[model samples]
Target: MTAATQTPMLAARNLSCVRGTQTLFTDLSLQLDAGQWLYLQGENGAGKTSLLRILAGLALPAAGSVHWQAQPISNQRSEYHADMLYLGHHASLKEDLTLTENLRSLIAMDGLKVSDAAIQDALTRMGLAKRQHLPARVLSAGQKRRGLLVRLLLRPAKLWLLDEPFNALDANAIVDLQECLKAHLKDGGMIVLTSHQTPDLGSDTAGFVLSLSRGRA
Candidate 1:
């Protein structure tokens, strides 16, 4: 008998993007399976962020489709979103809300129920224990980014779509996030992230890189 092939957790086929008159990319395809990471690399205006947005269902592709579990994402928006987490380049936090409150709101918006204690723990892990109760308006850029990253631990998602997750992070925070990514991959999660700088996932980790400059996978 022939061996059984595993279905990818996330897949994009022949995706094309256009912003006004400029064509960012075309015929782009990629697959991400459990325990794997796809690092997207390209220069500015290369559509790395656009492609990530398309995968997250925040925007549609000009051509082709994105699939989750081999099913077109358009057919199962709720389920797909529940299992995927997308953090864009910005902090996207409400300045009026405390860091803890912002995180709780995001969790509630996602329709996932996590305990207050769990949320606190995630924040603590992100090194925001002391500042968790402070309003986001007063936190530094790095603090806001760290607070946003707390969702990684609290979310029950299997796929992560992050754009420049390392931005504004200090050296220690970057290492902490790298550890978090490694831990997620260890547990059979999939990740697709765009970063201008190459991510250090250790010397032995298995992953792939797709450059938007090539215009296709």
Candidate 2:
């Protein structure tokens, strides 16, 4: 395709967000292609999560538009969402369900066809091999986060939108996450994430940072 007609993997143009009387950001734009990641950085209450929600199609921007493969996200909600995965800061788990059961159900909710063996392997890789049978209520915060991260192993989404993915992670878990991210980028996946801690996706991955402050980015 010619350069002028080429579509970006993801693009946000002149986005504006307002909560109550406060305008969090205005006229912000971003573009990401395969093998690239964008990091969202800001202080407390800078609308990082709000911006992520907008990009995920969970919330509406006050102005401007978001496009997936050059189509407005609102116009292609299902197709766009099918290729995107959004994970909030908190782990979404059923307190009464075991980690294994929770992972199974979550994958099912996405309509993914993953085998039990794959789930087991992902759990083991996340360092929850022994704890997979334990209820989420009994696991530590870090373990719960790891359980949620197992989706990254099973889901084949082209774009990943994560909010505070590194929260509650230990040193080893952090390293593991970095490796996972590196692999995702290597496979030509796009990622947008909000985090207080800077991510080290090694030296090869192309990563950019968008710093958000009150009413601007």
Candidate 3:
């Protein structure tokens, strides 16, 4: 690809992570260009979540670096964060707040202005429109997941870092979420996610896989 087309939205170089005494992975490198999707596969304790966090700039790597759009994330933290969204195992929603309230709060916290109509549109896209007035504490696992996913539509982020996004989702919800992700990628957005189950999103995008095992004692 030409230089104009060679720039990646996100890239990692020789990233090595250490959690306590455990070495998660070493010399890890990846490049996510626009409209691409990456699937991370590993055993339960293989540090997949840690890797995602590092890419999201939530945690620093023990060694090496992460770059967002050719700029070091360490130096351009705010700019990088402005263009990315990180959704972890915890949904980061207020249990006491209604679904709409939570979404509005998140958008405000991000310093982005979103209209109420847009918020409702996002909720409807995630299949949570009818329940938008209900507190998150009363929602089912899948509904809660849907409520969290509504952010994807409400905000404009170039990259999405999701950790086990399919958790607690039923088959139908899974399909719906897959479509949501597909639409994101189709719009030149990139995604990196870890999943125990395979993603059958029906897209022809290539994915890079990484696995980690304990070193010999």
Candidate 4:
């Protein structure tokens, strides 16, 4: 099939990861298409986070290759970085900077030009408008999480890689995040996240479940 006919926005072939003589997994393969979501389910130290880093091009897999839009990611590193967003366990925001400033820096790093008004709009959507001027270090845990989430709106990328996005979030914040994710998928963005809690999004939303134990068992 031609690249245009391939529905998957991201794909992995014979992917294997290893750390210090520990082989996390081998021959792991998956596909993520626009308007779809995938959940990485596993126990602690199951390499879920490592796999995500590899997919985001933050780290290299011990073997195999990753493809974005039918092109090998390694062949177009700069282009891949521009098209993917990866949020890990630690928020990338600067603790000393105000929420708005942190977001402004992030946008600048991505080499995108956005207006101040656009930044404010994204913060508002993530429920951080009222605290936009406050130092991110002083915000409550949930508010800090929301600050990180503002990236979703301020910058538009085709792929989202989230690791425990709901960490430190209250029930309401979790619900709000679920809504944001739903809207993202509806807009044809693909998501791959690792969460311990059951997802609030429904099963019909182009979902898949990958468990580390499946192959080991």
Clashes of each: 0, 0, 0, 0
A best-first ranking of the candidates according to their TM-score comes to: 2, 1, 4, 3
TM-score of 1: 0.95
The Cα RMSD of model 2 versus the native structure comes to: 2.3
Using TM-score as the yardstick, the better of models 2 and 4 is 2
Worst 10 residues of 3 by lDDT: 208-217
Cα error of candidate 2 at position 130, Å = 0.6
Local distance difference test values of all predictions, in order? 0.89, 0.91, 0.84, 0.86
* lDDT per residue as tens, model 3, 80-113: 8889999998868899999999999999999999
Q: RMSDs, each prediction? A: 2.8, 2.3, 2.7, 2.7
**Decoy 2 TM-score against native:** 0.96
- TM-scores of all candidate predictions against the true structure: 0.95, 0.96, 0.93, 0.93
How well is each residue in 114-208 modelled by candidate 4, as lDDT tens digits?
99999999888777889999888899887888899888887888899999999989888788889889988988998999999868786657777
Q: Which consecutive 10 residues in model 1 have the weakest lDDT in total?
A: 1-10
RMSD of 1: 2.8
Say which prediction, candidate 2 or candidate 4, comes out ahead on lDDT. Answer: 2
lDDT of 3: 0.84
**lDDT of candidate 2 over 46-115, digit per residue (tens):** 9999999999999999999999999999999889988999999878999999998998888888787789
